[model samples]
Target: MKKDLNGKITRGTQRTLDAFFDAMTALLQTKPFADISVNELCERAGYPRATFYNYFEDRDDLLTYCWIALSQRADSADLASVESSRRVDVALDAMADLLESNTAMLHAVLAHNPPDGPLFASLHRFIEHNARQLMLTCVDRDRFDLPADLIADHYANTLLLVLDWAYLRGHTLTRAQLHDYVHTLLRGVE
Candidate 1:
């Protein structure tokens, strides 16, 4: 969402954006991402095509916006200020809670988007990027022989791989199990 001169989205603009987000989410439950069209989104939102263009370039852009908005809502904590050793636990807890709350949406997306599909790939990349960012900030490179980037990427890959298996592949593990698995796996690294 574009901000005004003060770098803040106006209440009205935020409302409009939320309309589109809600529309996209509602559509996703029944329609595949690829099958959804701009017209459909606008109609669902009761907005015109011109109005959508004012905030987004296309459906793909809107999808990105939706994920980002969802992620932001999930990440309500200041993880950056958290103790390094606890950051992963806290981050995973937040994400697990988010996924648990949005299981229906997740299942809908997974049903349409195969592991190698564009939508899945986009989500995977976004998650990996987030994991890498957090790892880079929280990791103490001096504690490991590997370079920081490699360590960060490793941590991110581990996170993404585990999450994909647990949630994306229809597995039914509880959040507590996920935390235990990740903690046990990362004990050496931590």
Candidate 2:
């Protein structure tokens, strides 16, 4: 009934969900999330309205799922391999690569004018969790100058801000430049 970490949706359920996402992605390009209707989603997905209900309670649930899916991919080894200190640059490069690879899809999602709450929350949680874990692994807890919780929170917020800036600015900086900027930003944190 539920998808695995690998994103393997059960056959019947997967098809419906896949269609739903496809439709949502398509519709998002033309309208805001609030403007998209379940009926319209069903129509785009080529499934009946009942089919949409069978998978998701509503559009919000689908949006949450999409965020979770993207977070998972972002946190995977390919993207996560960069050390915490370098995560900013790594994130920038990865995002740029993704945007370039799927410009249309990214544009569609961003154009949708989706509510920022769920997306922000999802990213905040993911970055906080990873930053905390990375700090624990790399630094001696007793020697650490800052509270673990505080450090994690700070890093998470910084990452989010940097990402938002980059996204809004259309990623003008090169990957190396972005990496240097992140290092400078982190170094300044006392």
Q: What is the C-alpha lDDT of each candidate?
A: 0.80, 0.61
Candidate with the greatest TM-score versus the true structure: 1
lDDT of 1 by residue, 1-190 (tens): 4323246777888898899999998887786778999999999999999999988878888888888888877854676688777777787877777777898878876676676787888888888898788778777767889888888887777777777889888777877788788877776667
- What's the C-alpha lDDT at position 70 in model 1? 84
Q: TM-scores, in order shown?
A: 0.88, 0.72
* Candidate 2 per-residue C-alpha lDDT over 1-190 given as tens digits, one digit per residue, 9 for 90 to 100: 2344366556787677677877877887788677889889988989998777766777877776665555555523443455555554555555545445666666566655542644445444665565455443443235457776666566555655565556543666666665666666777563
Clashes of each: 0, 0
lDDT of 1: 0.80
Model 1 residue pairs with clashes:
none
How many angstroms is residue 76 displaced in model 2 relative to the true structure, after the best TM-score fit? 2.1
Model 2: CA > 4 A from native: 1-8, 78-96, 112-143, 169-171
Segments of candidate 1 deviating more than 4 angstroms = 1-6
